[model samples]
Target chain A: MGGATFKGGVHPDYRKELTASLAITAMPAPAKVVIPLQQHIGAPCEALVQVGDTVKLGQKIGESKGFVSAPVHASVSGTVVAIGPYNHPLGRKVEAITIESDGQDTWHEDIKPHGSLESLSPEEIKAIIREAGLVGMGGATFPAHVKLAPPPEKPIDTVIINGAECEPYLTADHRLMLEKPNELVFGLKIMLKALGASVGIIGIENNKPDALRVMRQAVEGEANISVVALPTKYPQGAEKMLIYATTRRKVPSGGLPMDVGVVNHNVGTAVAMCEALHKGKPLVERVVTVTGEGVARPANLMVRIGTLVSEVLKACGGLKETTRKLIIGGPMMGLAQTSADIPVIKGTSGILALTEENVDLSEPSTCIKCAKCVGACPVNLVPTFIAQAAEHELIQRAEKLHAADCIECGCCSFICPSRIPLTQWIRLAKADILERRRQQQK
Target chain B: MQVLYAVAALGGIGILFGVLLALVARFFAVQSDPRVEAVREVLPGANCGACGYAGCTNFAEAVVGGEAKIDGCIPGGSETAKEIAALLGQEAIETVPLVATVFCIGDNRMAKDLFVYDGIQDCAVAMKYANGFKACTYGCLGLGNCVRACPFEAITIGPGGLPVVDKEKCNGCGLCAKACPRNIIQILPKGTAGHLVLCASHDRGKSVTLACEVGCMACKACVKACPQEAITMQDNLAVIDLEKCDDCGECVAACKPGTIHPRRNLPVAAPRPQDQVAV
Candidate 1:
């Protein structure tokens, strides 16, 4: 079937067959969990529980006064053993609450159903979503309630559920769609009702035909909701690209989706919202895809939010001795971790372990003027030029070239014939330009 | 006869163009202060921008325009300042020469690494990945961004994975200080007869001991042992006020971590001359 697609993307060796068909298995909770306060992109939460205090499952342990932040909950019923700096998946030590599990699976008393979706008001739904600590589970980890509560001037007319797990070696969204399509649709209905949106679309890549079929069947009777197949491409799951592919809308550069009267949420985020609205559950557990050439048993496992990556790897038979790289997300945009001691945060989508054969250890060479990166940039930027400007400390030149417009999809670096690390250079340029702008304002 | 005629025609055109260019040059010349040119000649042409101006030429114009002080040229130090003051018919302000000093002593043998980092060879880029894998977060990454940024080749990565500043070559332009990601390179008054705190790690006693052998543990021994009370503990690190410090080695002998050393013994300071005093 013909599918809607975007411009300028690459097709890497998608090794989804490694775990696409493997059903998501629920792993037992580890003995201890380290939950960081700043999982979402906002103000970090303040710990509400002290050491030696007992907390139940789904208990709000940390919260912040900032409107953009999300609260953290106890993933497992346990005693707070420690509260201090700990390793996070984002590569720095953040203040975290460490709990030693009591081995008893317990739920909080407040985790009761909030009645049917039709009975809840828009304001009430948003409050419930915020109280549940819902965030974009597609690795962006932007608070979901923030998107639902757009300003009065920018009204959202369409809500898009991103089901395109386009990153290589990731099948968590695919498995979630096939197994829990009803919950996904239910969450979308809640979002539409909250935002007063008319149209609801589920954009799934054509690579996962089974997921597309299941999601389509789930949305058959809904008049405003439909599942559309998207061309399997890298970063098609990005909010702007997905909006363009499915609804023919162009989100302006340096603009949010609300600027185009659209709101997008990840499919996993939808499932989490449904659970929060129906079962009064907080975001405590999520599905993490563990797969790579170095993994002994690659599978999709339902994991707790605070679970250490080392424990997850052990459950999956651990990384092989040949593993040279341990990444926290997909291969394209994932962060290469130096140690397995970091805890999984809300933004973690997968744990990828790469062997020597799967990694490229060659030094970056000079650009050959191939212009392939220019063609591969989805945002229409000349990666080569921006990278050169960044290397020479020419911030003004890089800013004039629109370095801040880069979405950091790693397409330019992937398409580079010289392996010039175009994306890293552009990232530096973006940071420098932003810093310069900040200083000028001061 | 034809050759002579061709030469005369070409020579006539050349003389006419030369006269026209001379007249244009005289008419279109822009007026500037003659002292600006003279001041630029006496200033160091490094254009290192430590004076907060664009270059030596801009600074020279600013000085002639009475907008910049004669002591603003840091690389030129007292010599250029005296010359510029003489040209401007003003008293030369006394100035002290400054040099860049690395605060970290956690070399490869003394410091521990948290992990093996094989990414870009830039300290800034490596800092983006878990603060460059150095167990002492305040320690230098030794990636040589400062070496590349130095205009006079005054900095080099020593054998210990630490930056070694050539005090003689470094004009204290502060370019290396700006290039360092950790802010470990400090510009201080040179030729002080006091001890220097060689460690920048502010971690507590336990962490400092675990990370680096030369890290300051903030045990307060140096503070108590200082005869003039020149050292003070600030955020688990020792701060030495060189102005109050005497030439005694009390703090150096009292330091348990051995992070403090004599400034004169580091191959850093030359014998202070009579004219080197800052007024």
Candidate 2:
């Protein structure tokens, strides 16, 4: 169809077949849940419930007091057991509220279905999204309302729906498309209306033919909406990449999609919006794909946030004897966990386990300057140079090489023949460069 | 006549350019604080952001603007701090020279292996698998996160699969300590004799001994043997107060497992033989 796409992207083995065909199942509540305060990108929300406080499911347990934070909600009806430092997925102790489940699974009685998206105004929708504690479900965990509210000068012209489930070994978005296509379409329309945009485009990877067909049919005859199938590749769902692939536009460095008259949201985020607007549901649960060679059975499950990885593993027929590594999200960008005690957050799309044979623990080799990382970079950045600068502690040099522009899609590390940890170094460089800039300002 | 004509033409062109430049400079001139530029000129220009600024220039501006103090740059050492203090017309503040130290004593022999790591060699990545292959959950993963984190090439993975810091090359930027997920790397005072505790694990005696052969058991033997009483047990970890230490090498001899040792004038600790190591 001669669809628009950006240059320099790679295609990795998408092992989504392990659980792609499975229907979404509701996971039984875990015995205990550990809800971290800092689940989103900005400041951690302050905990409202202390030790011994009894809370119901969907109750707001943590409240956002800052401009760039998201509130936390209780996923189970339980008593707060502790509120001090607890083990977090980011490898440090953070203030987390531990809840001992009462097994009642009772809602707070205020969550009633609002019936349709047409009833809510843009401001009302934004308020509901904020109150529901909704964040970007595309593994970014950015506050959803903040994305909706751009500065008055930056007028958004186009709203793009990112249906491109490009990461390998994850198909939560694919399942949503096949099952909840109408909800996704409704949510897209709501987002476009809220942004005051006249047009919307849904960019789906060509790999998910069924999802594309279903979504295309759902949006048929809608004047302001269209669906475009992009070439299958890793990180096609990244905001800049999606904007570039669909509209042939380049978002400037250190700029957002809205800077170029566009805004993009993941399909899962759209569905979450629909739920928040229509069903009056907070973001307590999300679809997580439980799959890999290490599981006895693989399936997609709607799991509550703060549920333990061990609980999800148990629901998916427990781990096989050979299960060696547990990773959160897809294999490409997922963080390998220290233990199964870590809780699922809004950004978690999948829980993957790899057997001893499937797991790659090979020692990293020296870079051969293959420039595969360059070819694979959707942003046209030179990852190897950034890694080199970071290794030499030349952070300013790394910034000059555009280390801050790295999206950390794990494309460079994934495609590198040398198995060099390019993304990790770039991440460190980005952090240092940002900190340096901040310190300069202060 | 031709020479006169050429000279007149040249003179006319020069006059025109001079007038235009004056007009442009007068119209587009930007008014900035002269003190900011003056302070920037006096800075060490390392732009290390140790002063909590984006760069040396930014730090200079902040200091001139009264937003920051004089003693900000750790990488610049005390001399740079004194220069900055002089530029600000403030009394010079005394500063300590800091250095990075690897707290883990877990080598191949001391620490047990979980599995053979063959993937991307990064402590952060290695730490994804139940705290890497090290039997001590708190020990260094030896994937060289600190090596990668060091901007000065001060830290490197030695032959024993543990990080070794070169004190001479270390700038004490504290980047390695922050980069560590296990938080084993520490920035301590680079003492006069460069002697300090070599172990960092806070685990109790038996568990520490079981996890790694060379781990600090917190037996307090060193604390008792110190004539200056510089060593104290805090949170089950023996911390040697550098201010009180006299560098007598008494703690080194008193340590039963040889966890505490002098950084200089000590025999090079050899790596355990490969065949004797367990997978």
Candidate 3:
């Protein structure tokens, strides 16, 4: 299929078929949920409610004074059981609020429709979105309001909705597109109004033609909005790549989508935005894809935010006995969890359980000068050279090679003939570089 | 006659270049302090940057230029300090000998791990993943980053998955302390007879009991029993000030988890019998 795509990216087995056709099934509010205070890529929120305080669904429990942070709401009407460090999907213990469900399914009093989309002004729409705690739900978890409010100098002319569910064994975005195309389009309109942008484009991979068709029909009457089928490739849904695929714009190195007069949001984020604007509902629930050969029943379930992964897995018939690796997202870029006790935050898109057959445990062999990793790097980095430099702790050399630009997409590791963990090495180098920069700044 | 001509021509060119090189060498000669070379010669040539300079040469230059202390060479200790001072016609400030000490005693057998870490074999890298899959967040990761960072081969992973510092080999360069992500390794004065706390866990008493067998629970038993009042509770951990501690062994006895021991009793003081025999 002829469609738009960026430069270099690897094509792994797209095992999205397990949950792509499954309808979004609503998993009941779990008996207990662990809501981490810091779910986005900014300042962590401080807990507003203490233990033993009864909270309602959509009640703001955590908020930060920092401008870059977003508020966190209770996913269920429940009593706050604990407020301390808990396991988060990002593989760290963060301050979280544990709540035992009241099982009332009661909405908060403040949750009410503001008005029609046309009735709300641009400023009001942005305010609504900010208060609703909406973030990029495609696992990046960047606060959405910050993206909407770029500096006055960088004017955004186009907004692209990322529907490229490109990662292997993830179909959360695909199912959302097929089920809620109108809400996705309406959400795009609201964003366009908020940013005062003229054009809206929904970019979907060619593998999901049904979603592409439905989205195309959803935007039939709109003049500025269009649906562009992207060539199926890993990381095509990445902000930079998606901007290029949809608008032929190149976001510069170490730059954001706003640098190229564009902004991108995930399909799940758009639907969440629609709910936030129309229903005044906060971000308390999200669709999580639980699938793999190790899962007894692979499914796409509408999981409550802060629900434990163990409970989510249980709702999907639990993990098989042979399951060895439990990942929080897709296999390529997801964090391999050590236990099933982590909570599902806003960024969690998939919970994948891999059996020992898929979990490769062999020690990484030495690189034999094969440039397969170089060919597969989506950011065009020499993975072997960076990995070697990182291995030797040559932070300066790694920095010189622009290791900070790596998106940590795991393309190099997936395509390496030697099974070298190039991505992990690069990640180390990147972390060291960032730490060095932080020290220098101090 | 032809052989004579060829030899004369080649010899003329060679002599001309030789004279030119000599002239260049004389004209572009660099003026350096003679004591810098002498000081560098006396320094331990490890170039470990323990002196806060680039290497031995740079440190020696700094010393000669009055920009660095005469006792800055940590690995060379007081002997090199005296030599440097003598070369500079100054009195040497006696450098105190120091050795590294790994504080945590929670090894693979004593400390429980929350999960098996199966990724990059580096402490810093592992610390970023779920704050390390260790039950105690402040314990040694046993990934051996310190062992790799030690230029003198002073550190090694012991049989129980804890770093053991060889006091004789360690020169208090503080490289291992800097390389450690958990900040559990510390530089202590050598031959100081004092009681040392082996556990660095700042966890509460209940959590400490659940996580490790030898972790400090901050029970204040040592604080109450210390004769010199050397022990104090800080952030759910008991700290013993060596300057005040007199190797009384009372605090060691009072420690419920057996986390405190006499400094000489640690394996770090002397693990090799052959070195002791020679001494």
lDDT of 3: 0.89
Write the residue-wise lDDT of candidate 3 on B1-279 in tens digits.
999999999999999999999999999998877888888899999999999999999999999999998889999999998989889887533388789999998877677787766667899888887788679989999899899989899998987778988888998888899999999999888885988888888889999999988899989999999999999899999998989988889997888888998888884321223432211
Q: What is the lDDT of residue B278 in candidate 2?
A: 46
For residues B1-279, write the lDDT of model 1, one tens digit per residue.
999999999999999999999999999988878899899999989999999999999999999999998899999999999999999987533366788998888876677787766655799998898878789888888888899889899998886678889889998889999998899999988885888888888889899999988889989899999989899999999999998989698988899878998887763222234463211
Tens-place lDDT digits, model 3, residues A1-442: 2276777898988888888899999999999999999999999999999999999999999999887888999999989999999987776679999999999978889999999998989889888888899999999999999899999999999999999988999999999999999999999999999999999999999999899889989999999999999999998988888888888888899999899999999999999999998899999999999999999999999999999999999988999998888998999988888789989999999999998889887777889979988887778889899999999989999999999999998888888888888899999999899999999999
Classified by CAPRI criteria, candidate 2 counts as: incorrect
Candidate 3 colliding pairs, count? 0
The runs of at least 3 residues in candidate 3 whose Cα sits more than 4 Å from the true structure, single-residue gaps closed, are A43-55, A61-67, A78-85, A93-99, A438-442, B1-98, B166-168, B188-197, B217-279
User: Each model's DockQ?
Assistant: 0.32, 0.17, 0.42
Worst 10 residues of 3 chain A by lDDT: A1-10
Instruction: Pick out the ten consecutive residues of candidate 3 chain B with the lowest summed lDDT.
Output: B270-279
Per-residue lDDT over A282-339 for candidate 1, one digit per residue giving the tens place of the 0 to 100 score: 9999999999998999999999989999999999999999898999999999999989
Better candidate by DockQ, 1 or 2: 1
Candidate 1, position B112, lDDT: 78
Candidate 1 chain A, which ten residues in sequence have the lowest lDDT sum? A1-10
Model 2: lDDT equals 0.83
The superposed Cα distance between candidate 2 and the true structure at residue B176, in angstroms, equals 12
